[model samples]
Target: MKDHHQHELDSRYRRAALPPLGALRCFEAAARLGSFTQAARELHLTHGAVSRAVRSIEDALAVELFERRSQRVFLTAAGERLRDAAGAAFDVLAAAVRELREPPGAPALVLSCEPTLLMRWLIPRLPGFHARHPGIALRLVAGGGPVEFDGVDLAIRRDDFDWGRRVHAQRLFEERVGPVCSAGYRQQHLQGQGRGARWDDGAALLHSATRPGAWADWSRAARRRLPAGQNQSFEHFYFSLQAAVAGVGVAIGPWQLVRDDIDAGVLVAPMGFLADGSAYHLLSPRPIQAGSVGAQLLAWLCEQA
Candidate 1:
């Protein structure tokens, strides 16, 4: 056994050369488990192979790694130092392997879209999309209003279908806005107030601040002569939705964002009269971007909506 082990670690082998991968592998495993026997078990080798690997490593390093006591092995100061270094080195190697294995496509996708869509629609389904498209990674920047899309790959927007010619938008789904309120709020303040009469008088109107002029457009389309605007408003749809869900006030938001709420009975669109048919869009500076892999994502979104 001694002669065979000596043959394995030749004296002619240069110690200053790069360390052996198999020996480093054995060391990392043993360091992680803190037991050579466990490392041998995991690596599917006999305890002798693991011990030999460790011995070869120690010989190469010209360092004392362990103080053997009975059957148990303890890491010396030098072993502890090498363990830390080897762990970090393995982590870097694993990262490099992952990068090399990644498929070819866009390095990163910058998605700028409405806060409402980001939270309500897009985010919830992102994990599934990632599972299917492992090669693509998305970095989302949720901002209300026109994002300086100079560096962005794509922007998901909510606007009228006829958005002029400055920017190109692919129509995804037309949104319909109406009085969205919690079930409790409708029971308290809105039950049987008569169609249009409830909103005609002041009834704690929670206006969405993102779409300031939106209430007016809704009122006009529905021919609702609103007597007063209570002006309990919020800039973000997520906030306004929460407020409405909490039975604070009646908020006006897109059907797409509030669709789940309406379905789950968290909210109810009291008067469907406010449906204006404003479509959500995927806006891009150059329309040709829609033809890229990101465009495939857009196509999926349009189908889902």
Candidate 2:
């Protein structure tokens, strides 16, 4: 990398035994404005200083590069060529200096999200975010727990716990949930069942150990009797949702988490959606300032919700 950068600098800055940078600046300004006095004013140098710099450049190149008239100066044929080359060189140098002086990009966002939400919802939307804000990097950590705000910039989570005063919460969307199953499972087991059919009579119940009562709450809201059979349990909600998507069983999933799957026909909501009072929120230790990458990401999340 160092070799490549050096090569770039060499190609840009070295094409001839050029005059000093200050002399080149004086030459270009004097040639462009067609007057040594105006170039001196522009460069904050005296007219004699500009004349000496131009004479020095001409001596270095061994060419009479400018035509001097009474109180006026203009580029000769050789001087015009030098002026063009010098202007192009200065443009590249100015760009390099600008890049060096520009403030470093916003620090990469350290975000924490629930594993299930990260996998099912947030991951799918990341490509869009990256496309929009390519300068902003993201580091995602997964878990739904008491978040430590020291290293993390944002956390996407369901609002079910007491987050302390240091953490600020912004509601993204209310958590609406329903039972979802693979398309194949629904076709094989539920297609022939009429509207009054007992869908849960023999179907397997996929449970998340993290949210043990999700199935019960969904069943109560859907007004369906809980299946009596022993069901499979996963260590996390993501695993349960994966099992459901793989046609293992019916899993109670939040609408936001499973909406894409349903729309893509990977998972079908055999039962309809239910709006529970719970909500999803974007949480941070402190409020994000306007025009920051974190603020843009938060706004995008709210739009997605």
Candidate 3:
């Protein structure tokens, strides 16, 4: 049971191959540019190729599409009708592709990332991303766990879990972690052995409630037992790192999160860095194909990492 509109669309699709896309493109360029020679130059084709393509379209439609004059061309009645229709059709096609390649909300590319990664890593690097991709409007949302594919187009997370086929995953880099504290805090609180201080030297332990065992895991890697010291816990890693940055306590810091601070001398990695075998991964909805804005972003992230 086909409706009239459905039948018409079906017939259009069935007969779409008549003139062929190549011939239509050539015709459009020739019509718009006013010369087959100019159209060939714009298309990087031989002038004869453009002429043949135009002739092919006219032959297929059984109608002349141009009026040849002394070293000039004009659109015939049929040619004028086709030029308008083809121009409109190509415009619609181009718009559809632009909409599909970009994130659903026109210019904005919605991103979901772990709060710590967003605050400490991604946000800092966003200026370069903007410079490289001025057309991609980035909208960042902070949270962690399985990517909510509802409205978000991409996510950055540090996890080893499977995201399934609906999501495309690319490993950016492995996570290295260690204890970090403000340089001023170390100078004020730790007396002498600030050069290679032990965690047992009475610095407060800033714990992330989300990852309570971070200290213990780091301890195992460094092969040192952390003393049971004054404990302060924060609900999230971002807060815990902030507490450390504020000189309140030592926080188990992922290398990427604390790298800039450490390099800038704001934070000191007392125990250096250790790899815990985890990685930061870029996740995007699988519906986004290669060469799209999301895919381009993933490539940029990998390069930056």
Candidate 4:
């Protein structure tokens, strides 16, 4: 009798009035990105397929969800309402999927961090964390900007942008930035330059595509004007820093990221580091319980900083 009752409940759920999951997914993506073309790219579906999926949803609901004007898409009133509902639903589903994929009996904390920090700083210190807390498994994903703590337990980011007020944040350390170069390059090109000397126009200026304004920001904070020089851009901040270490050029280096290099004589900060009015922060969705693995990791990080 219990089995029969359970089977009936499942059948009822199957017969519920709901749009096709695929259509809902397509509609949600289109609404969120405000571009069917971009949504198609994200979903790896053809643009026409995405359009048709959205059209099917509109037909079923009998409402236009988007307004098309000047080759741009804008969400209509109905779209905004549906977007909020669909986005929330997707977030819940995604979190569930992540939980389901984890190995049984092995609890893990997922930490999202900025790419350069992960590469240059956190990774080198992870051995210490593992040695201290062997029972807790740590998973790291590289990211920046506003963190979506769906599957992430913690995120480390510099306070360069607003990450909204929903999450609890703790200050890690103040950011200090300065121009750094390989020791060889400093000796050859900047041997006679004294502290806070004007930047030379002969040396190449290394730029990161990720942080194009880093040099400018440092210049502004140091109250000095940067003279024009040969510019070389790298795809990532870490790459630019590495280029600086390889004697390619001088790059704006965050003190934390280049501290070991400077201490080891691999790099030199002729101008020294200056506060850029930003600080690194550890962010989480909720206050971490004291003595928990997350809290342990947080405390360790604070000690390291």
Question: For each candidate, what is the lDDT?
Answer: 0.72, 0.79, 0.80, 0.83
Ranking by lDDT: 4, 3, 2, 1
In candidate 2, which residue pairs clash? none
Q: Which TM-score value belongs to model 2?
A: 0.62
Q: What is the Cα-based lDDT of residue 12 in candidate 4?
A: 83
Give the alpha carbon lDDT tens digit for every residue of 13-98 in model 3: 98875688888999999998899999999999999999999999888878889988997888775776577557656754664465
lDDT of 1 by residue, 1-305 (tens): 56966865765454447578888889888987989989999999989999999999899779977768997888775776576557655654664465456786667677787766776777656667767767666667666556457778778877743445777777888777787888777776663555634653546777665677767787788777654647677765566766777677888767877887788897888776345766778877776464677787887777668
lDDT of candidate 4 over 105-209, digit per residue (tens): 666788998877876678667768878876777777778999989888899998888888888998899999999998778766663456547656778899998
Model 1 local distance difference test score? 0.72
By lDDT, the best candidate is 4
Per-residue alpha-carbon lDDT of model 2 for 14-97, expressed as tens digits? 755567888989999998888888999999999999999999999988998787777566666577656655654564455346
Best TM-score among the predictions, by candidate number:
4
RMSD of 4: 16.1
Clashing pairs in 3: none
Candidate 2: worst-modelled 10 consecutive residues by lDDT? 191-200
Q: Which window of ten consecutive residues has the lowest lDDT sum in model 3?
A: 191-200
Worst 10 residues of 1 by lDDT: 191-200
What is the TM-score ranking, best to worst?
4, 2, 3, 1
